[model samples]
Target: MLIKTFSYTSLFLSFLLVMTGCKDEDYALPVPKSELQNDAIKRTLGPNLVGLDIEFAYAMAILPEKGKIVSAQVEASIAGATGTYLEHRSYYTNGSGEDVGVEVAAPSTTTGATSSVTFNRDTSAATLRYFYRIPEEARGKTVSFTFSAKSSNGESVSYAMGPYTITNMDMKLDMVATDAAACYISIEDMAIYTAAEAAANPGKIDLVYLHRTPTGLTFNHALVSPAADPQYLPGVTLPAGVNRSTKVNKVWNLRDFHLARLQYGVYIDDVDFQELNLEGAPNFAINVRAEAGVWAETADGRYRAYIYVNKVNNGAKNATISMKRYTMP
Candidate 1:
C-alpha cells in the first residue's frame, strides 16, 4: 500500500472553498429552523459487490442538542431506473466499534431497497447494514442514497444522498476456526513456507500477516519482485469476487483464501483508518499504504478473524500485523 501526503497550504485553501460554498441560502436553509441540527457526511462506500458492505457515515453535530431524531432512515435507488430498488442486509457498528452482526427490523415493505429503510437510533449510530444482497443487474452501476431525518416536532428533512459508483471488489473470504493466540511473524516466514509445510499443517495457518519488514524493503524492491513471494512483499489477497483488482500493482486485495497487508498501524488497535475508510484518509503515505479493520469468517464456518495490517515497509520488504480471533457461535 502507498501513502499520499498533502501540504498544509493546500488543505487550508480547500477549507476556505468549503466555507465559501456554505454561504448560500440553499445550503443554509435546506432544513427547517425548528430543527436546527447539522450533519457532517463522513463518507459513503460501496455497494461493495464482494462483501456486500454498503456503508455510509454522517455525524449529527446538533441532533443531540436539539432533540432526539424520531425517524431516521436511508433510501437508495438505482440512478435513472425510476422504481427499481435494491435490498439491504443490515449490520450495525458505532465509530471504530465492535462488529455487531445483523440487526432485525420490524418486517416492513418500506425497509426494503425500493423503500426507505428506517433506523432504530438517530444520533450518529447510523451505519448501513448489509442485509440486502445487490442484484446482478445493479452490480458495477451507480446507486443513489437518500437520508431522511425527522425530529419529534414534525420538522423533517430529506438529504439527497450521494451518487456512489459500485465496485466489483470481492470482500467475502474463507475464514476458519483457530485457537492460536495473537502472534507476529517476519515476511520471510510467511512467504517462504514450503509446499510440504502447507499440506502438513492443513488448517493450522489462517491469517497472513503484513507489516514493515524488520529489515525494510524499498519501493524499488516491490517493482522488481514477481508474484507474492518473500523476495517481493506480497499484497494481501482480497476475498473472492469481481471486486478483486484485475491488474496486480504489487498492492494486494482481500480474498477469501488470501489476505493482503497494508502499513497502517504499529499495533492492532492503532491502524490509521478503518478497512472501510478508503476515501476519507486514504491509508497510503508516500509509497506505503495502511488499512486495518478487516473482518471475515473461516472456510469451514468455524472461526473468524478481524485482521489488521499494522504497517508495511516496501523498501525493506517487511511488514507488521495484528488480529483479533473469534470462534463463531
Candidate 2:
C-alpha cells in the first residue's frame, strides 16, 4: 500500500461557515473565540470515485501525536459507479514550515470500461496512527488543517478543523471486541514517528497472530513466507468459496470463514520506533508458525503468527489483522 501526504491554504470559521444549530438564537453573541490564520490549503489529489463513507478515528490516524495522525480519508458511495472523487488538500504548517497534519490515503476505485454494472470501490477507513518522537520544533505550537474535495465532474469544496493544537507525543493501544464467543478488535499502532533514517534496510513485514483456543478455534494471521516453510497442509484443496483451510499452511480472511481465533501481533508490542531505521528495527522480520497436532476425535488448533501495518507515512492510514481461520471448508 502507498502513503499519501496533503498540503494546504486557508479560511472560514465561527460555526456559521459549516454549521447550523438548535441554539436559542441564530446570531448567538459570537461564541468567545480567537482568530486562526496559521494554515493553508492546496490541490493535493485531483479526483476519484469509490463507494462508501470513510472515517479517520484519532486512535487510528498515523502521525506526530502518540495516537494522533497526519492522515486523510475517502468517503463515498456509488450505485453502479466505481468511485467518488474526494480530494483537494490543505496543509497545517508550524513556524518552521513542517507538515504537522493528517495524510489521507490515495483513493483507488475500479470500474469496468464496458459495463457500468461492474464496479469496484473501496471504503475501508485508511487510518494512520502514530506520534512524533524527536524534539519536534512544532510541539506546543498551534497549527491548522484545511481540507477540500473534488467532484467526479470537476467541481470543488473545502473544510477546516478550526484552530488545533500540535500536542506532545502520547502513544496508546486498545482493543474493542466485535462479537460473542469471538469479538472484532481495532488495534491501534501507537508508535513514535521517525524519519526513515538508517542504512541498508529492506523494510520488513509485521505479522499479527491469532492463536486458536482449546476448543478448536482461532484466527489465522498472515502467511509464513515459503522460504521459512513450517508444516502446513501441502495438498488439501479448498472447496469453492473457500480461500484457505485451517490445514496449517494458509492465510485466511475472517469474512470468508466462520471459525474462532485469538489475535496476537508482535510489532504492536515489540517495535520501538525510536530505534527503527533504514535497516529498519533490529529483529528477524521472518517467523515460522507452530503447527497443531490432532487429538481425540476433535482437534483444537490455530496458526501462531502476527499481522501489522508497516509504518507507511502517507496521506491516509492502514493498520489491521485478518480475523478468520486459515483452513479449508
Candidate 3:
C-alpha cells in the first residue's frame, strides 16, 4: 500500500542503489598492457648486405596476464642520403618470429624495397625473426623497424628496434697488406696476398701471413696457436677452380695448400673449404674457385672479419680474399 504512493523515478533510483550494493567491486583495476623494454629486447642482424638473404631476429618478453598477444607488425623506414626517406612494406610475423605464409606487397627495388621476405613468430613470448633479401638501394643507408603487438583484450603495444645500416664494405672487397714478420694476420685488415710478397725466408716464415690473389688464397694454418712456434711455411693454399661440388673428397696436403713443398704437420680437407657469396656482388662468382669463410680476430678483439676466399692461383702463388669487417658495438 505504501509503494502505491511512491514516485516512479524514486523507486527506480532506490532499486538501482540496491542492485549496485548487491555486487562486489574490485578495488584493484587491471594495469595497462606493457611493451617489452629496450634493454630486455634482443635484436640481431645476420650478415647484413644488399641483395642477400639477411636474417633479423627480435626476442622480447611478454608479461603474463597482459592478455594473449594476438598479432604483431613491423614498419620499416629506409633513410636516404639526402636527408629524405622512403617507407617499405609492412611485415607481419607470429609471436615465434616466423613469417606468415602470405605475400606482402613491396615497392620498387630502386626505392630500397626488398623482394623476398620471410619471418617467424612465437606464440607465447614476443620472439620474431625476419629473413629478407636486402635491396640494392638499402646499401649505405640506415633502415629502422618499428614493431607493434596487439593483445586479445584490444590492448596494443609498440617497440622501436634498430636503425641498422647496410654497408657497401661488405660487397666492395678491399685489398690490404701486413708485414710478413707480424705474428698474427688479422682478417680485419681485409688483406689479400700479392705475388710480390712471399714468406719464404726464415724471419718471414716465423710469423703468420695472408696473401689473397685472383687465383688463390694462402694463409698459415700451422701457426694457429699463439704458443706454437712458427714452422717453416706452414701455410695452406686454396687454388682457384676448386669448389665444393667439383673438389669433393679431395685431400689438401702440402702441395695443394702450400706455396712450395714446406710442411709443418698440418693437413686440410677439401670438405673443410666453405664457400660464401656477397649478397649482390656479381664478381663474387668470377675467377673464384676453392673458397671458404674464415674469421680472424684482433688482439683486443675489438675488430673482426668474416672473410671469404674468392680465388686461389697456386701457379702464380697468390690468392684473393674478400671480407666484411665488423666492430663491436
Residue 131 local lDDT, model 1: 29
CA shift at 179, candidate 3, in angstroms?
Answer: 26
Order the numbered candidates by TM-score, best leading: 1, 3, 2
**Candidate 3: where are CA atoms >4 Å away?**
1-47, 60-64, 79-124, 170-329
Question: Over the stretch 220-242, how does candidate 2's per-residue lDDT look in tens digits?
Answer: 32222212223321222222221
lDDT by residue for model 3 over 1-329, one digit each (tens)?
55765777688899999999899866898874364422114233333556544444444344655545455554567522221221122335789997554322232222232222222222335445444455667866777766555655566566675667665433325232232332333333434333233232221111133333422443322213222322323343322321111101111222222212133333222112222222232111112233443443334434434444445544544444444555543
Model 1, residue 271: C-alpha shift (Å): 27
Cα RMSD to the true fold for all candidates = 16.9, 24.2, 20.3
TM-score of each: 0.34, 0.17, 0.33
lDDT of 1 by residue, 1-329 (tens): 12234576678889999999888664454564444343425232322342343445432223455665444455668422232322233345668896554432333244445444444444422333322344555655667666565655556666665565554333323222111112111121222222244344434433333333334544321111112243333443322220111111222333221233223222222122123222232111223244433443333444434443445555444444443443433
Runs off by more than 4 Å, candidate 1: 1-47, 58-68, 79-110, 114-133, 169-329
Clashes of 1: 67
Per-candidate local distance difference test: 0.37, 0.23, 0.39
Superposition error at 126 for model 1 (Å): 8.2
